[model samples]
Target: MAEEKLLEIKDLHVTVDGTEVLKGVSLSVGEGEIHALFGPNGSGKTTLLNTVIGFARYHVTQGSIWFKGQDITNATIDERARLGVGISFQRPPTIRGVTLRSLISFSSPSLTDEEIERTAERLDAREFLDREINAGLSGGEMKRTEMLQIILQSPDFVCLDEPESGVDLENMALIGKAARIALGRDSFDGAGCRSIKSRRADYKAGLVITHTGQIMDHIFVDKGHVLMNGEIVCSGNAAELLGEIRSHGYTECFRCAGCAGRRA
Candidate 1:
């Protein structure tokens, strides 16, 4: 028997400001699997993530979003989140008075104070959590905080948009470590390790959107899809697709008649 599906998106069509952004997009993710969405800038990667999380501005004119076994095409953002869907925005918002600690604690009340502190430390977000949310935070700091929230929430499915954008050589390893912990790898010590492992077991599905493919090198990306003009043009194993993208950008792979003919 095949593994049960965790997320199902069928004939997904989305438009923003009267301009079509996603055209007949269809994809599925199974439990315990990682699916990578790769595309050039403005290729609708973020649009798809927003649509999955029920962003109101991007209208889903047609299609449906199913989670676990329920149709959630019209669910609100908070509704989807409570139902085990979480998203880390490519450009996270900055709330003036909200502290990172408060926001994270509010989202995940199960975490102990020490667990939260350890999580922040692993993501290199220990310093910023006490500060205003995303206020005066560097790009890497914002990314780390986003990763921290996903870890704490332990959602069934996570949507990560450009997870490695602002990371530099110095802190890239730390970010990668945190991502591995979220993916269920056992590398930490004490309660942190146990908590992360439990979260990993609970986190059965994910949609990772990346441009540089650097994240794939660190984590095991199960499948990859190439997006262009708001549509998936090609899908393949993570290793093969990452190689193609690295050698030649999305233009060469997405536009090639031969590559486009094959399904992901």
Candidate 2:
């Protein structure tokens, strides 16, 4: 049997300020799979995520975005979001005078108070929700808030950009737990230790973009792709590629094999 495709990008080309950022880039994520995208700064990781979210500023000069078997290349940001696509930005926006509870309640009206508290507690974000969206929020607090949104939305596909960026080691485990919950690996209370096996049976997919591979250490990443100069230089299994990246930095990897002479 063939695998179901959750997202498909074909020959994507993007430009910003009249300069091309993504050139002939293509990628696919299947249901329930976690795929990591690794690249150095300015390699277009965030730009790619922005394009996937249908940001009008990042023009897709040529390409197509297929989500859950439908063509959404031309869809607006709101349109894609209504279709169960969620994005956790690298720098979450601040909402002045808007409490976190209000924001979440506005986005997801179905969540009960108890459910909201549980989700917030699991993500270590219970205290921050009472405050403004990002007012005086520490790095960890911001990440937790983002995780809370993920739980509330329960999106079919999620794109996380640099989730571990400013998080400390103490809160890293909680972040991992939240991600597992989103992936359906284990529940908020750790009831389903065996659910990791069952979680792989579902069709929830995640696209993670990272500069540091710290988050990959906590989860089971299925595949890894190296992005350089706005395009994928090579693809490999998670362990092997991660190991290579650990032993040798992006500069070495770029000159190793598939991307020796590529220019941005």
Candidate 3:
């Protein structure tokens, strides 16, 4: 049986600030699956995520992006958000005046104050709720807040960039818990108490970019793709691919015709 694809990109070409960053890139993330994207620095990993989320500066010169059977190649960021697409940025900027609690409230208005408090408690973020958005936050704190926003938004598909970057093992575990809830891998109120088997059909989908592969310790990744020099040159089992990359750097991928042939 074939998996139902939730997000698809066909031969995507994107440029940032008039310089091409992605070249003929293509991939699909299926319903209830999480795909890890592995690449070296400046390998267009972040570029791909920004493009998928409809960031203005990432101009798509060719190809199409489809979500839930609709072509959204030219959709605005707000339109993408409305269509159940969300992103957790690698380095989220600080918003000087907006309180984190107020922002979360705005994003998910139906949840009562108590419900918000409980959710914050689950992420170990109750103390930071009153702080200004992304202001004076440690790397781990910012990542946890990103997960909290994703959980509250409850998007059908999400793109997370470096969720484990710059965080210690302790906070990494918390981020993982929040991610599981966001992806419906665990029940919202009871993080690890319930089985996802009962809710498999409606589980959220995700694409996560990782340079270190440490995020794998927290979440299940069904597949992986390696992007190099603006093109995807490898695709395979997430853990195995990570192992190979760790043993031999990205240069080894160039020798494997089977992996590099994926784009051909």
Candidate 4:
């Protein structure tokens, strides 16, 4: 039996600032599967993520986006969040008045104070919970805090943009572990491992965008796609694709003639 698809992007064409960024991009992520997206800078990688999360600036001029079989192409960000879609931006904004603890609670109202505290502690972020969200924090600190909120949000589908962009090795490891927990994989205490079928039934899925592929060392990714010139050119095993991209660069992907009009 095959797993149900959690996210489907079909022929997506997005425009930002009056210029098209995503050109007919399409990809599908099955429940319990984590897909890695690799592309050079300015390849519309972030544009695709922002568009999926329903950012207004990323206008969808054509195509559709579906979540859990529901058409969410025109859904508002709040509506999408309520439907269990959460995203961690590459460069999140700072809210001077709101503390991290407050934002985490707001992200998931059902989470108890103790539960939030435990998650923060697990991420080694207990000390910063009372501080303003993303205000005056170091690069690694910001990434870890973002991961903590993501875990607390506990969304069924997670879209992480460059989670390992500026973090150090130690912080990257912590972020990776928290990411696994958010996706219903292993937890911080080294337990809570679930089978792929079980995870799928629970609707846990993730799509991570990375340039260095360092995060792949910590979290398990089912597949990878190369996005260049605003289109996915190759799709295959995550590790293998990463290796090829590392060895020959994205120029190697041009040989495949792009994944146009085909589902990943």
Measured against the true structure, the TM-scores of the candidates, in listed sequence, are 0.91, 0.92, 0.93, 0.92
lDDT tens per residue, model 3, 1-264: 987788999999999999999999989988888999988999999999999999999999999999999999999998999999998988999999999899989977887889888888888888889999999999998998888888888899989999988789877777877777777887655636245556566778999999888888878899899999999888888887888788788888546554554432
* TM-score attained by model 4: 0.92
What is residue 179's positional error in candidate 4, in angstroms? 1.2
Better of 1 and 4 by TM-score: 4
Identify the leading candidate in terms of TM-score.
3
Q: Could you tell me the C-alpha RMSD of candidate 1 in Å?
A: 2.8
RMSD of each: 2.8, 2.7, 2.0, 2.7
List ranges where model 1 is wrong by over 4 Å.
Answer: 190-203, 254-261
Candidate 3: where is the Cα deviation over 4 Å?
Answer: 188-199, 254-264
Q: Report how far off residue 193 is in candidate 1 (Å).
A: 9.8
Among all windows of ten consecutive residues in candidate 2, which has the lowest summed lDDT? 255-264
Go through the candidates in order and give each one's C-alpha lDDT.
Answer: 0.83, 0.82, 0.87, 0.85
Q: Candidate 1, 97: how far from true, in Å?
A: 0.8
Q: List the residue pairs that clash in candidate 1.
A: 235-264
Q: Between which residue pairs do clashes occur in model 2? A: 32-204
Q: What does candidate 3 score on TM?
A: 0.93
Note the clash tally of each candidate.
Answer: 1, 1, 0, 0
- lDDT winner: 3
For candidate 2, lDDT tens digit of each residue in 1-264? 888889998999999888999988888888888889988899998999899999888998998889989999999998898998988878998889999998888888888878888888767688987898988888888998998898788888988898888899998888887777776666766686474455564746888987777888767888778888888887767666666777788767645554444322
Query: Which is superior by lDDT, 1 or 3?
Result: 3
Please give, for residues 1-264, the per-residue lDDT of candidate 4 as tens digits: 866789999999999999988899999998778999999999999999888899889999999999989999999999999999988878988899999988888778899999989988888889989999888988788888888888888888999999987898867778887777777777677756664335345647999999988888888899898898888877888887777777777886435434333224
